[model samples]
Target chain A: MDMKEFKLNYYEKLYLARHFEDELMKLFADNKVVGWIHSNKGHEVIGVSLALAMKSHDYIVPHHRDRPAYLAKGLSAKSLLAEIMGKTTGCCGGIGGELHIMDVETRIYGPTGVLGSNLPIALGIAYANKLAGNDHVVVCNFGEGGSNRGSFHEVLNMAALWSLPIVFVCENNKFVEFTPMQKHMNIEDVARRASGYDIEGIIADAFNPMETYETFKYAIEKARRGDGPTLVEAKTYRLDGHYEGDPMKYRDEEEKKYWLERDPIIGFKASLLNESIANESELESLEASVHQVLKEAVEFALKSEPLKVSDTFKNVYA
Target chain B: MTKINFRWAITHALDEELARDDKVFLVGQDVGESGGVFGLTRGLYEKYGGWRVKDTPISEEGITGLAVGAGMIGHRPVVEIMYMDFISLAIEQLANQAAKTFYVSGGKIKVPMVVRTLAGGGFKAGIHHSQSLESWFTHIPGLKVVYPSTPYDVKGLLKSSIRDDNPVVFIEHKGLFSLKGEVPDEEYTIPLGKADIKREGSDVTIISYGKSVHQSLEAAEALAEEGICAEVIDLRTLVPLDKETILKSVEKTNRAMVVYEATKESGFGAEVSSIISEELIYDLDAPVRRIAGAFTPIPLGDAEDAHFPTVEEIIKVAKEMCY
Candidate 1:
């Protein structure tokens, strides 16, 4: 694809993710979708950039807040909505709700509800790739809060020791649920934890798609060449509450406004237009296309059948 | 048939399975060049190389998580968690990830892995080194729990557990590791969910597994001399429990008793007693008895001797139910 086409593609993905989260929140309010809805509004660029850099054969272990990662990894919006709504047509047949999203064909492993749990499992996938002599790299995504989990330290040490082909991407939104990063851990930068494991660490501006995409591409290439795992800390923010319906009393208005000004979708759209990659009319058309796709997805999810009683009993064994 | 120790039977089973399929591999601490803590993987590491017989750090959750991930991608990983006591460290991986993978993925993923851990008391290993936690895994659905008594059963059941497309927790008794039994020299396998009749009788039925099975067998012999004619049934697998065999034996004997090495409170014997009462209460002549350990942490040294149910206790239960 040409530069113009590539830039358009990335913008479309970012716009689609932003709109998807907006649509999901609206559905939650209307009672069409139930359960906790985590909107990944500001984390879209990191997920989209990582997806852009990853090969089709490579696998990804996404985070619970990474609906964007799931979409970029080929999970259909309709199925994601269906699963979130607890319908039978969901990707996991409604057994796994919003917290758990995976696509075996796309090699999207998991995002278990338990934080930092997916790290070790992602290492296993990387180990499997190494054992099979495949040059595929596994990308594991989690938040700064997850870095404090024992699983993070344990898995990083093992990954370095085994020289596994994997990348640990920590999206630092500066909050552990409701608490700020200052109260959660002693260190400010999560990338510094990588040095304790003897792995190279890199920090990138997650708001800049080009920087995030370039850093991921370099790390992924290093893993494919058997250079072992790399820890990439993408500094970003959460544009919405920890979960939908969360009262924002814990967060100050100043911090919220600060992050809102740097919203990934808006900044990326401006960049796309400034570079003359696309005109205003073209960008608006792309935005309209994304809105149309998500509208159809919501309708499909609403029309999908509810799970049967036997569906819960199925797949318990094999 | 050839006579072998329970430890060797386990080693031989792992050796054969590793050789049978290239996808089969072992992972755990000291599992590679140093064999295993109990010398279970002895010479296989040198033969299969370090990658196949992987030696890992003292990270229980990490290594088990690796096995789960590898198993999900079509690799058969056999993980040895030195002792059953350490299983608490890795329970998150086994119960949450390994057990639920196949089901939660909508049947798109399969975690074909086996966790081999040494269990039971009498080693004076105390609470940290010794435990009978089979009841924990049996409580979790989508997980197979196998506790074998003799060398023959351990060897056959282990092979089947490795080949089976599900996560299995294979518990080996530390006390019974040195016990000898006859096993076929040729290749063979025992299915998971079958109970073997160690001793046949007609009066009272005793159901046990692991180290308790041997105790029940000895008790049955003593009962036979006293004309009590007690029947001993060894349940090889706990999850896919052979309820039919248990009910049939209970019907014939008209009395039932369950024995295990774990503590009495909420132990596996309680489940067995409930099943017997729920299904065969009319056929039973007496209330089901449970012979088990006291509800206390295993003490140190010889103090742990009386911690487990003894052969005398089994005999007393059988005699009480009969007379």
Candidate 2:
């Protein structure tokens, strides 16, 4: 967990997630990848940094925009690509497509399609851990828009009142779908709402992986120490449109340019070079390796067979 | 054999399962110190403590979602929805999450959980507290729907539900809570999808479950006094329905009647009647009849009695086929 190693790991995962989304966008345009694609282009650093702070056995109930989180949890890129391609070799055997990618073996509870639905599930998993006399924490990820859901309030209250070992991470990327945060709610920060639940609310610079990692690490440790849940709000922006095919008419030019200038990957790379942590050549090699990994993932997914129609009825029961 | 009330039979099943497996735990509103709204989980919190018999917030959706997650992690969680009507709040968790988790996970996960709720309208608890919604869970795949009538059936079916590897919706009639029935003292379990023959006859067959089974049995007795033998088949489980027992009874009697406490429109009895007509069309001597609750909201007071099918109505339906 040295700075050099952490920098490399963060850059590698971010590159993988970025390239994965890029490839998915291409495939989606060609109609090779089915279903709606929620790109994690700008939110990668936030998801990956938080994921890195979690233990292997600890549960991660991910939001739909959690490609980097899955990569950080060590799920095979080929399996995720295969899932997007609706292949039998996918993580869920192609039963759940882009919206639902789950791996029980990795303790990644998968992404919930419904807004804020996984919060209670994550709280329950933490409850189970507490009941079993374990200190394992559960991390529940959702967007700023999902914070308005009743489940958000219900789960937070339960988790706080019971002193459950869990962390609620809200990736506040400004806009929720097509609606901006201001239009959705009057509050400037979603974390401020956590005070009502009697939990500490903290905000982090989502574009900075180091900041997100350190913040989530503290929150996760506090949870594992039986200190109850903490609400961490990461201020970031969605680099791309809400979905792959979203029209860009709703967003203005200046707002988009402001976020693009502070793009996490470019900023992190500049920091790595300026701090003399990694030379330009080393960063180039890391980027090349990530490209190779994603190329092979796409190849594996393309070569995998699509699930048969008969497979639909296979797991309907035990 | 020992005689116990229906509620105790359920409590005994919970106690046994909690003792049998360390992973089994109960979560619901008022299930701990208050012993549940209906006292169904009485004495459980005292024996197992608060950790096992947990009292949760009045959030059905939250509790159900929590149980689904715990079940995915190899814990058998039995969630109690205070009333069957409130299950509407938890349909997303139960139908979308719990019922689809196993299938959507591609067999990677199993949601071994039970949602215990009370149905029927005999107590006059009004619209919110009393409603027969067993058909809702029966319609969902990846979920087992169990509605037992007698204390013996409730004990056995509940044990089977806890051991089941899929999510099970166990519906107990509110009116049948204090009904007494003979249960075996020794350890035993009745398999799901198996129908129980409460009474045997030959003239006609009456298929029902839950509180309706009692009415059907009483109607059969009345029919027997009039020299018209009506066989009664209590369908223990609805989803994994025992079509074999139902069809066999219909084939022998050549007359079938489906009884239920829910509305007639798209009720569970319609499924039974359809099955009888589809599979045993040639075995019937008369058109299959369904005696169900009136297609309206269950009203309060004595008006609720008119909403549910009475023993007299069952006897009349049986006589219509007998003549």
TM-score between model 2 and native: 0.98
lDDT of 2 by residue, B2-94 (tens): 999999999999999999999999999999999988888899999999989999988888888889888888899999998899999899888
Which pairs clash (backbone N, Cα, C closer than 3 Å) in model 2? none
All-Cα superposition RMSD per candidate: 1.0, 1.1
- Pairs of colliding residues, candidate 1: none
Off by over 4 Å in 2: none
State the lDDT of candidate 1 residue by residue for B1-323, as single tens digits. Answer: 99999999999999999999988999999999988888999999999988899999999998899888888888999999999999998999999988898888778788999999999986887988878999999999999999999999999999999999999999999999899999999999999999999999899999999999999999999888999998899999998999999999999999999999998889999999999999988888999999998899988888887888989988887888888
Q: How displaced is residue B127 in candidate 1, in Å?
A: 1.7
The per-prediction tally of clashing pairs is 0, 0
lDDT of model 2 at position B110 = 88
Worst 10 residues of 2 chain A by lDDT: A104-113
lDDT of residue A267 for candidate 2: 90
lDDT of 2 by residue, A1-318 (tens): 887998888888888888889999988898988678888888898878877898988889989888888888899899999998899999999889988888987788846788788887887788889889997889999999999988888899889899999999999988889888899898999999999999999999998888899999999999999998999999998888899889867798898898899998889889999999999999999999988988999899988999899888799999
